[model samples]
Target: MTQQSATQGSTQAQQSTAATDAPLLDVDVRATFQEQFEALAASRGEVTALIDATDTSTFAQLEARTNQLARHFQERGAEVGDFVLISSRIGSLIMHAAIAAWKIGAVPMPVSDKLVQSELDAIVEVGSPALAVDTTDRALSVPRITDLSAADELSADPLPAVVSPQLKSPTSGGSTGRPKLIVSGAVGDPAAIAQLGRVMGVPENGVCLITAALYHNASFSDALAALTLGNTTVLMERFDPETTLVMIEKHRATWVYAVPAMMQRIWKLPDDVKFGYDLSSVETFFHVAAPCPQWLKRAWIDWLGADVIYELYGPTEGQAATALTGAEWLEHPGSVGTPKVGEVSIRDDDGNPVPVGETGEVWLRRGVGEPPSYHYLGAEAESAEDQWETVGDIGRVDEDGYLYLTDRRSDMLLVGGVNVYPAEVEAVSDMHPAVLASCCVGIPDEDLGSVPALIIETADGEVPGDFDGFLTEHLAKVKRPRHIVGTTRQLRDAAGKIRKREIKREFLEPTAQS
Candidate 1:
C-alpha cells in the first residue's frame, strides 16, 4: 500500500503544472531526481542554481551542462543502476558531475577528495563503478573523467528519463578511513525526498550555504536538497572560519549546513574577528556527524538564537534518527531530544529493553516487518530478532524518552573495569583557552587494559606544559588522561570524525605519516 501511494505520487508529480507557480512547483515536484533540474530549467531558466568560489551556474545552464555530461557518462558505459564514483576537488564541477550521474540514472557516490591510492583501491573493489571522476588526474581502477571540458561538446538534449535504483550511495566515513558504501533504499520516492529536504531546513527559493567538503554525505545531500527544493546553493571550495560568515552574509543565505568541527574553528576566532562579519542572514543552522560537545553546543545557542540551531544524531544505516532544535536542547541539556521519526529504545546485550536512564546499546525499529532503509557494502549491521538494529552506538534514554549518548562501543575503553568514553574527556579539555581541538584515545596499559591519553591540536602549535593539570579539575580520576601530548597535525577529518582507531595507530606511532 505504501509503495502504491509513492508510485501514484511519482506519476502525478511528473505532469506539468500551471504557469507563475511552475518554477516553485518544479522544485516541489516528486519525480526522478533529474526531473527537478529539468523542470527548474524550463520554468526558472535565469535563476542561479549553484555557486562556488570561482563560478556560478543558472538552472538552465546546469540543466544543459548536465544533459551533455550525462551523455558523456553513457558513452563511457554508465547506465541505469551503475555506480559513478566522484572524487574531485571542491567546486561547482563536482556537483555538476553528480547531477550528470543522476541524469543518466546512475548512482552517484562521492568519496574523499584526497583519497590515498590504497583507500581508492579498497573502495573501487567494492564500488565497481562504471566510471570515476577525479579532477586531480590520479590513476583510478575505472574509466576516469580527468578533464571537465571533455564533456562540453556532447549534445545537451534531454536523455530518456529513468529513476535511480537508490537515491544515492555515500561512502560511510570515507574521508576518515572507514570506506563502506551506504546504499539508500529509497528509489527517488518524491514524498521521502521532500521530507528529507524539510528535515535539513531547506526553504523554498532560499539560499543555502555549504561550508564543508561535499564528500561528506550529510553536507552534499543537503546541498542536493536545497537545489531540489528550488533554492540557490553556495558551495565553499574550502572551509575557512571567517569566510563562512562572509559567504552567508554575501548570499543572505537562509539555510546553512555545517558540522561541529567547523563550528569550533569559527568559535576559536577572536571575538572581534568573528563579529566582523554580519551573520544575521543565516536562519537554519544544521549540524551533525558526531555527538556535539556540551560546551560548544551551548556556546552556539548563546551566540545564535536557540530557535535557529538544530542537530541530528543517527547512523548512516537509516534505521534510526533523533533530532532537536536548540530551544528543545535547553530543556534536556545533554539529550539529543525525543525521536522525530523511528522508534528508539535502549537494549541490553540480550536485546531486551533496559530501564529508562540506564546506559545500554541504542537500537531502533522503523517497523516490525518493514523493509530495510539501507544496506551496507563493506560492513554489516548488528540487528536483533525484531526489526531493531544498532550501529554499535551506546546510549540511554530518560523517563521522558529523550536520548543521551554515552559513546560508540567501539570507541569506549574499559578503564580499570569502568567504561570511559572519549567525548567527555575531549569536551572538558577543549574548554582550555590554549586548545583548538583535542582527541582522547585509550593507550594500551598493562594494569587497566587501556588508559586514557590526551592529544591536542593548538592554533599556535605550542603545547601547554601544564594542560594535564587543567584537566585535573574537570575530569574524574577514571576519565582523566594519564599522559598529555600535542601535535600540529590535523585531528579530525572533513567528516568531523576523530577516527580514534586511526589516531591510535598513526599519532601514537610516529613513523606513519613520514
Candidate 2:
C-alpha cells in the first residue's frame, strides 16, 4: 500500500480499537500490572506481545513469566509499597521483573545496568529498595537476586493481584549533583493508562518500536503504554542506526519512541541504505527527551511526511507537557508546541512573570485542582510559593503561544554580564560536518566572570582547523566559545544528554588547583 493509504488505514484501526472502547477485562485503580497483562493475555493470547534480539514471546508466555517472577518476589519477603531496584539491562527479563514488582504491590526502580559500584551504592542508599536485581556478585546489606533463573525456578501460576501506590520510581539527576528518584503519584489504573496512551498517540494493537535505553523515563513509559494497549512492542537491545530502520520495517511498527541523538544517527546513514527500509507502516513517530536540531527535524519530516512526525517536550515529573506535529513545527520553526496538559509560564530570577518572547526560567504546574504529579526522594524540587516548579530549564513563549526552549538554567554562561545558552552555541557547533558531537560549558574567566568553552568530538578524530571560522557566521562574539577542545571521545550520553556540570568540573578543577 502507498504510504498515505497505510497511514490512513492505521489511523482508522487505531480509532476503532481505542483502549477505552475495547472489550478489555475490567480493572480497578488498585489492580496490579500483572492483572492488566493477564486480561490482555486472555484476549490476545496467541498474538506476539514482545520482540527482542533473542526471541519473541506471546502475551500468554509473558503473562506466565510475570506470574512466576511475582511469586519469587513474594517468597523473598517483598510486600506492598516496597521498592525493587532493577539494575539489569533492557530485555524481557527486566520487563517481567517490573510487572512482578507491581503484581506484589511494590514499585520498580530501574538503575542503569552499567553503573559503577560507587554510583550504584549512592542510588541504593537513596532508594533503599527492598531487593536488588543484578547479575554481578556484589555483597550488600540488602537481599539480592543474582539472575532471573531464581525466579524461573518458581511456579508460573497466577498470583493474587495487588497494585502499588505508585506506578514507578524513575531516576533523574538533572544538571546538578546526585540522582534522585521521582516517584510517580498515580497508581496503575487501566483506564488512566489508556487515556495516557490516547494522549501520547499510541495506537491500540499497533506495533511500537523502542530504540532508547529502557532506563530512560520516556523509553520505559512508552513501552509500558504500548503494552497496556495490547500493542506489540519491539525492544532493541542496543540502538544502531541501520538496525533500527530494519526492525521497524520487519515489525511493521506503527508507533516508535526516539530521542534526538538517535534520529541524527539514522539521518546520517547512507542515502541508499536509509531509504531501503519500508517504514510506511509508521503512523506516529514520537520523539522526546532532548531538544531536536532544526535540520534533523526537517529531514525526518521530509522523509516521513509532516503528519507522522511528532515531538514532545516535558519533564519526568509530569507537571506539564508540550507536543508539536511536523506541520505545526514548520510554521513555528523552533517552537516545541503549546502547553497541552498543564500551564506554562516564564519567570525571572525574582519569580516574576516575563513578557512574551523574553527568555526566563520555565515554570510548570498542573491544571487547577489537579494534584502534583510526582515527588522527589533524594533531592528537593525547585518551586515558587504558588507551587509552580521549574526543572531548571530556560525558555520563552511566542505570541502564538508556542514554547521555545533555550537551555538548561544550570548550563547557562555569563559572558561579560550577557547570558549565553550552551544549546545555542552547541547547535551552531554541531552544524559543522566534521563535528560528531559537541558539549558547551562555562569556564571561569577573570574578565567576563564566566565564558563558554566547547569540547568537541570530531567525526574523523581530527579537529577541524577552521572551527573558529565556522562559528563566525552563526554566532555573535560573546556567544562563541572562548576555547575549543577537541577529542575523539563522545561528549553526550546514549540519551543525547550532556552532564554539563560534570564536564565543567573536569575542565576547571585542574586549572583551579594549579
- Which candidate achieves the best lDDT against the true structure? 2
List model 1 lDDT by residue over 404-463, tens digit each.
Answer: 888877778899999899888988888887787888888777788888887888866667
**RMSD values, in order shown:** 7.6, 8.3
What TM-score, over all chains together, does every model reach?
A: 0.91, 0.90
**Worst 10-residue lDDT window, candidate 1:** 15-24
Question: Which run of 10 residues does model 2 get worst, by summed lDDT?
Answer: 14-23
Model 2 over residues 1-514: C-alpha lDDT tens digits? Answer: 1111112253323211111222233323224566788888889989998887766899998888888888888888788999998866646666777778888888888777767777778788899999877755555558888767777778887787666888889887746568789998778555555555555677888899988777777787777777778889999888888999999998899998888878877887779999999999999999988888888789899999999999888898988888889999999998888766676777677776666677888878775466788999999987765457888889888776788899888778888989898898888888787776788887788888888888888766676989899898889999988777787876777666787677767665665344
C-alpha lDDT values of all predictions:
0.77, 0.78
TM-score of 2: 0.90
Candidate 2: give the clashing pairs. Answer: none
